[model samples]
Target: MLRWLRQLFNTSPLEFDESWRPELVSGFQHWSLLSQAELDRMEMLVTRFMATIDWEAANGFELTEQIKVLIAAQASMLLLGLDLDGYDDVTSVIVHPANVRLRGNRPSGGGTFSSAPIVISGQAHYQGPVLLSWAAARRGARFPEHGHNVVYHEFAHRLDMLDGVTDGTPPLEDAAAMARWTAVCTAAYDEVRAQGSPVLRPYAGTNPAEFFAVATEVFFNQPHELCEHEPALYGELRSFYGQDPAARISRPRRHHQHG
Candidate 1:
């Protein structure tokens, strides 16, 4: 009975065709230059990713081919290690030109009409929807060295909220892991709030939810800096994420450069 019920609710991940344009970049060259076998693997990932999203169009991307690919790749990477790991709760992804126009300071508004610093490149609604600026996502993919990735930032929030709330806690696979994660993440959150300037980002100090998003940005962007500056916090992030970006930060990530 349980199996049948699960089957009834299961849907495939969100998958898009290979219609987007390509860019020539050394760092993210894999998206354009990966071998057929690798590309096939990426496609598989994309298919599983589709299961996680109920993709809707806001303002579709009008940017360069590279930007579109880059944004898709980052969103794909967030789902790399898990099955059915796309933004399952989200039914749509609204892509805009840049920092979306603000309707007000309300956090409840959807992406199509919102204002900001309004330098937000991406934002995750509490209900599991996402809004990303194609320009910011492309820029982050082009330059992953800096500590700013709108894709990672926003997607991380979605992941964190999977536990039924948009708190810093995401779904942990085990109690032991959850305990360690809580300890470390809480410590990091407190430190960031107290110091005003954190190893991850000042924005993380904005709130617990923002801390998760900002930490994700640093995790994918300034990994080594995060490790060097805040080794304890970095260790926690590494433990929770099950990936070590610092290792790749030092060397070129040919095998895992899709994100």
Candidate 2:
């Protein structure tokens, strides 16, 4: 079905519905932070993402336009500075009513795996679908200051997987940039694993893959805090993502004061 849809969409592109603007405004906190040009691009990306991906609802959950728009908007935020091809590995999006539970062997640090039942808000697979919880997605989109966005986290994993490796380092522009990213991220990862980070949560220490995702959340959601705590790490992310969310987030406030 997805392949067929993709083929069909190839013939004619999906149109962005102007009506979804309200959903974007209400469902996503970052909506207001975007410049006019960025908002236009975001709408285009959101329409492409929603139309191309095969969406599914689990646990008898009913999917709605609001939910889809909310999720797509957040996912598109990551690509606001990059090309849409960053998420090419993501073929589908499966949304559950709440956290997903599965009993299996999972990563538990120390290069070891633990066989236990774990519940997660979201999961990203290699060359596969992205699974998310609608409840968590809604909360994250509406409350980005919490610095945890499942859509950002999972889609970030997809971005990291674009280079065919999920070692936390996404495709860099050159060897020089790659070396810098390695140095900065490695130092931060070591700190998180040993002493811990105030901006990054404990889960980031689980692995480099997770460290990237959690850092992505902080980079966008809590840009100022992350920038203040880890300037080099934040610089690496800003350079890689081609976005300075701290400035975008602060521009509005500076305007309101004079207005």
Candidate 3:
């Protein structure tokens, strides 16, 4: 009876395809930087993500395995040191062939909106599906040095929303960590709004939520630049995300660039 019950309760993890390894290594620049253990963990997350999320292709775009894996791998990277439940609210992922154009009220600036046909690469809705442009996602994965990844940006918004708020700050370990995060992020956000930053792009200054998402893009893509220019922000992100990307990446410093 005990053996029968054991078999009844048995379960298996999702299988990861070996063929996807090359696709990931070739498409994602950061794939080569992960340790063996981290790689194993990432594979687990990737498989689960690809299997769990409801993936859709807009405009009759062909949704291939390559697209799913590439997007899943990047999304999983964010949860490397965190729990998968952080994304429990995300039920679907919609991919567009290119930039999404919407003729609706869009945020202009300073707490206002304009009814213009705005083109966006990605968008994250609170407790809703994430929208991504395949062109932007593919470019961001293959060329991370540009410091603008739609997947990272949208998923970071999802993380920020996990606390039931769309503000820049995500859930922290404790009050002390939250305090430090606020201080650091506020300072950086203010600087970006005022004098502007070399590492962070102008779009980051749009709002606190966008700032966090944009910073996440730079934190992973241009770790060296962020570590060098905005050490405090980088340190806060490193502690919060539980990953020191600067240590994993080894590249000579170059002039700051944005995507």
* Model 1 Cα lDDT, one tens digit per residue, 1-259: 1434333445433444555433423435225534555466566665544433444445554544444455666776666544544465665667787777554654533444434434556778777468887777767777765567788888888888877787787888799977887788788888877775435656677677888888877776767667766777788777676667666444533222221
Write model 2 residue lDDT over 174-239, tens digit each, in one string. 999999999999999999999888789988988899999999998998888888889999999999
Ranking by lDDT: 3, 2, 1
> Which stretches in model 3 have alpha-carbon errors above 4 Å?
1-12, 107-111
Cα TM-score per model: 0.74, 0.92, 0.92
The superposed Cα distance between candidate 3 and the true structure at residue 48, in angstroms, equals 0.5
Q: Write the per-residue lDDT of candidate 3 for residues 131-202, one digit (tens) a residue.
A: 999999999999887788999999999999989998999999899999999999999999999989999998
Whole-model Cα lDDT of every candidate shown, in order = 0.64, 0.87, 0.87
Question: How many clashing pairs does model 3 include?
Answer: 0
**Candidate 3 worst ten-residue window by lDDT:** 1-10
How many backbone clashes can be found in candidate 1? 12
